[model samples]
Target: MSLKIALFGITRDIVGTSVIELPAPAPATVGELLAEMRRQYPALGELRSCAVAVNNEYANADQPLHTVDEIALIPPVAGG
Candidate 1:
């Protein structure tokens, strides 16, 4: 299955794109996707923190991923 991930903030900068296409097996987990992201874009691993969202809702590490899901990578944010 091919998942399209929307990138935000520093994630977009690190990935150099607004969207990314990740190929994974059926029913991939959030953890698995994250591991693959770190492998494909090591810079993403440098962030202080990152969050994954599916269908506009925050997802847990064990959450299952679907091919039609709308995934997003949200990097850490700092404000004074």
Candidate 2:
């Protein structure tokens, strides 16, 4: 299944875009998707410590993601 992914925080810079498309296995979970993302974008290594959100709501790594779901990568905030 294909899903739309949104990048926030530092993830956007790493990906060089605010959005991307990804194909995930059936019955995909946030964790599974993340793993695939890491495989696809080795530069996204920092994703290991990032948070994930589905359709604007915080999601756990184990949460099952439906096809076409909007996923966002949210890294921890850092500022002065």
Candidate 3:
């Protein structure tokens, strides 16, 4: 499974990269993906809030995933 995810802001800091591949035998849904991410990157779990997008649209936890889908992780942003 080759699901690539783009990361922004603090998510990048937590993951130490702007993009990452979902581990082999990819998650089937957004929630599963998040759980797996927190497993691999515990720092990601510390964030109070984060947003996930699939194919450029805001996604829900139950949203299905596919190897072809475009994914992104958005961390909460503070407006100055």
**Positional deviation of 32 in candidate 2, in angstroms?**
0.5
Q: Per the 3 Å backbone cut-off, how many clashing residue pairs does candidate 1 have?
A: 0
lDDT of 2 at 34: 79
Give the 10-residue window scoring lowest on summed lDDT in candidate 1: 20-29
Separate clash counts for every candidate = 0, 0, 0
Question: In candidate 1, residue 59 scores what lDDT?
Answer: 92
Superposed Cα deviation of residue 16, candidate 3 (Å)? 0.9
Tens-place lDDT per residue, model 2, 46-80, is 55477789988989989988876778887886779
RMSD of each: 1.9, 2.4, 1.5
Error of 3 at 38 (Å): 0.7
Single out the weakest 10-residue window by summed lDDT for candidate 3: 70-79
lDDT of 3 by residue, 1-80 (tens): 76899999899988999999877788889998888888998988889887789998989999999988999987787889
Candidate 2 ranges with C-alpha deviation above 4 Å: 24-27
Q: 33-52 in candidate 1: lDDT tens per residue?
A: 89989988999998898889
Worst 10 residues of 2 by lDDT: 20-29
Off by over 4 Å in 3: none
